[model samples]
Target: MSRAEANTNSPKRERIKRKKQQQGRKDHVEVCALIPVFLVSRARNLLYSHLMNSR
Candidate 1:
């Protein structure tokens, strides 16, 4: 169901909260893509090292 349909039986506050959450998720995805590839690769290497050490 759409946001409007889902908030049909809810109050204005709940609708506003849901709207903000949806917008935040979209913003996060956009920012994630703009991150530098070098930084991303470094992060991946760090995580891989951690995983290897834990195993």
Candidate 2:
């Protein structure tokens, strides 16, 4: 309610916001990294299946 209390809470709120942003960015990076791996593996599996079917 008071300005001093607001000022104290602002820093804590900012820290929490920053932590959440960092975590979101970290998750985004992990998902981005995994997508290519998943695509490669999926492509490999499809290719293997096609080759087996052709044989």
Candidate 3:
């Protein structure tokens, strides 16, 4: 199982984990970066569809 593999690989994983900790929360930053663009595109599509339908 992957859990067993990770247990075996814990030393390497720990090193990588420490490196990520030093890198200042990259996962949160990436999600934050994506959300606004996703919302904006959806809003723009809905607005365009409404405008077309109103004509």
Candidate 4:
């Protein structure tokens, strides 16, 4: 309601927003890193299955 109250709330909101953005970026980076690992594992599994089936 008051300007002083709004000012105090703004800083806290900004901090929360910044923290959320940082967390989202961190998660995105982790997911990006994991994607290659996941793909590699999936490829290995597929290759193993193919080899076994061919034999």
Per-residue accuracy of model 3 over 1-55 as CA lDDT, tens digit each = 9998988899988999899896777877888999999999999999999999999
Worst 10-residue lDDT window for candidate 3 reads 22-31
Worst 10 residues of 1 by lDDT: 4-13
List where candidate 2 sits over 4 angstroms from the true fold: none
**Number of clashing residue pairs, candidate 4:** 0
lDDT for 32 (candidate 3): 94
lDDT of 2 by residue, 1-55 (tens): 6999999999999999999999999999999999999999999999999999999
Models 1 onward score TM values of: 0.44, 0.84, 0.60, 0.78
Residue 26: error of model 4 in Å?
Answer: 1.5
1-55 in candidate 4: lDDT tens per residue? 6999998999999999999999999999999999999999999999999999999
Candidate with best TM-score = 2
Worst 10 residues of 2 by lDDT: 1-10
Residue 26 in model 1: lDDT? 97
Give the true-structure RMSD of model 3.
8.0
Worst 10 residues of 4 by lDDT: 1-10
Q: Which candidate model has the greater lDDT, 3 or 4?
A: 4
> Candidate 1 lDDT, tens digit per residue, 1-55?
7888767757877889999999999999888887887688999999999999999
